[model samples]
Target: MSLSFERTQSVGIIGGGPGGYEAALAAAQLGAEVTLVERAGVGGSAVITDVVPSKSLIATADSAVAISEASDLGVQLFATSDVGRPLAPQIAINLAAVNRRLLSLAGQQSDDLRGQLVDAGVRIISGHGRLDGERAIVASTGPGGTDFDRIEADTIVVAVGASPRELPTARPDGERILTWTQLYDMKALPDHLIVVGSGVTGAEFASAYMNLGAQVTLISSRERVLPGEDRDAAAVIEKVFTRGGMTVLSTSRADSVVRDGDGVLVTLSDGRTVSGSHCLLAVGSIPNTKDLGLEDAGVQLTDSGHIQVNRVARTSVPNIYAAGDCTTFVPLASVASMQGRTAVFHALGDTVIPLEQRRIAANIFTAPEIATVGHSEQDLEDGTVRGFVHKLPLSANARAKMMGVRDGFVKIIASEGSGTVIGGVIVAPKASELIYPIAIAVERRLTVDQLSRVFAVFPSLTASITDVARAMHIVGSDDES
Candidate 1:
């Protein structure tokens, strides 16, 4: 039977990640009968385990860090002068309470989203959804040997998000060796934690656990932590981590990880072993593109196991589409939602714009968040675009001085000839929130002069934006002279 989406035709979306749910909402709004099949909960990996829980954990970590800096705000702390007594802070976090609250929040968000979907007239099902054939899905509930139920829809969306990638030798036992997804289940903190891979996820977990009073050792294959981020920002965070008693090992690769009697040992490629009470593997994520009959259904897949899709999220087959972490596009919640909406628009013959990666803003929710918008210095060197770079230190900002912050800075890059802001980076306490304005500038191609014309509150960290804008004047003069 041929797949045809009539007014009363049903549309099926697999995986309940941001992409899947958002697409369901869009399709339902367009008056299409929608069915969403989810193997896990509605929030997917990002909302349930990865992004939301980790960020909530980082919030607690930030509170812990703030206590140390509270002294400058005329707050005094009297250390216990008694002998054989602990000098650590009197207020301690209850790991159990924190974990419970984190899970509760994640569940709440998931429930709220599910409620909205239900109210919007989308049918939700709990089962493993797989492509039975073109325009057909076979979903099985319970364990193996169950009869596969059939779900036929004119259009099918594959939003099956990725799972945490595990190294072969250091596979997670869900106890001594754990993935980031399993960390929220922990009630007791590890005495010492060895985090393998110094990418964004690894660095974030290492920093979070360290702030929560665990001794941490971060192993990086590259020369520095956060190797994929801005170089200067990486350097600043490395210094902060080292100063805060984190053991950072660079240029080291773990060959294998094995659990010993009471701890885990990670042997490096150079034959050196790192021992700790627990080990976390944060290598990266692999797309969940296997066993969905993609090969049989005529959908192309990347060499790295990601589903191959065009800018509008169209698969090789005209009737099929894919989005979220399952695809090769950057696996972000924001990007996933946009892709989902765009996929539906393009499918419906509505006005649809292909995804523009340059306009997307990304943030790393570490203690001091790292947010980036637009092009990078490497982007310019790669001949993707040409831009001028200007950096403004946050230390000079009145608000930063008042807050007792000495680290972090903001850097903005603009096209040399047009003075149009193309990209920017913010490394500060709330860089995640701060990056929005810069993202707007990048998306609109706002000129540096236009950005400078906006009035910024005096004595606030937002003043840093003006500082960067003012520096552009110097850059402009140097360009002319």
Candidate 2:
């Protein structure tokens, strides 16, 4: 008997975002006939707009902050006057140049990604795509939008990402009032920036602009900022925001936003008014799953229009899968890529490992970044998980003292009796880089003692992780968080 097939397995992916890009590559490498339909050029919004450009802007902001921090270490920066006398240096950000550079970088990345897909033998379609029942995808191709191309496949993956949520009362004009995507068009920084909402997006922009020398007013409907994050972490960020000269109007709401002369005016729910040169609406995002023929294909979606998926990214329809912000998952780019690969693997009879929330790392890119992995302290309060927490402020770390750091901390969460590293949080500069080891421990189910045995470089920020793990180590099963 001989094992053979008449045709190779086929996969069709919608969108060219992180999820779709990874899925297309994986499927092609697996010797499956792959076709990827993308409306945008390539690399999607994550590389083209949201993550790449936003983080590049943040990097510029961090450089500006470093100038001030240098003074604390007795490093003075001075400018020479025309007569040769020393003068106080002025800090300026050429926002137009920054925007141009970041945008160019994003475009280059998108081009590189397209090249990779072509090299991997994945057919790339440049157009809008939607589900054609369960086994095929129909794309509107070419400049005139009249040409249609249909791809029939053994499996289909949907990775169309989401867009910023827009409220009718606070409509974005793309000039004064803008969404996050429109931010790169500004030639100069706003005289005053009013950020509405206190979620992760709002806080990040608020911090960035304030650090960039703009007057920022943050309006939050909750009593405190970053409502669902760790309380201590939120407090630290709030303190930093205030000290950086940001005005946080908590427990307030923006009822309406309208053009006020050359600026903008926001009417509050409490009968107050806040005015600024520009306003940003960072409330949330809605999935881009609309009009994708999901319902017609029997693919289930949440009431909010997000596609529902299982751990392996399988949709309600047997042969269809969804990933990225369009799926009802964590909505991070890394998670989306993982989900995409898992979907293809499970469909092609490859070894598949399901996704787990406890092993996913989340980060907020504020001035002092907040990063976390696995279970949080809030999980214990909800009665869904039992754990203890241990906290060690960054101020106590030797490297922090040498670097003139004053804010942030490292917190550890462990199984109550087993001392397994269940979760951890770090608040500091580049906390994203520091939180990875903890994520590994959570994924590998490493105990506190096991992690403490691993050596970290001396007098480094990561040494603090080892130190905290040592502090939280259980002796005879009676202690540690």
Summarize candidate 2's per-residue lDDT along 118-185 as a digit string, tens digits: 99999999999999999999999888778999999899999999999999899999999999999999
- Which segments of candidate 1 are over 4 A away from where they belong? 1-6, 77-88, 143-147, 474-481
Identify the runs in model 2 with alpha carbons over 4 angstroms from their true place: 1-6, 477-481
Please write out the lDDT profile of model 1 over residues 267-339, one tens digit for every residue.
Answer: 9999999889999999999888888898998888989889888899999999889999899888788999998
Supply the global lDDT for candidate 2.
Answer: 0.92
Return the top candidate by TM-score: 2
- lDDT for 35 in candidate 2 is 97
Q: How many residue pairs clash in all the candidates, one count each?
A: 0, 0
What is candidate 2's TM-score against the reference? 0.97
- Pull out the clashing pairs in model 2: none
Pairs in steric clash, model 1:
none
Q: Model 1 lDDT vs. the true structure?
A: 0.87
Q: What is the C-alpha lDDT of each candidate?
A: 0.87, 0.92
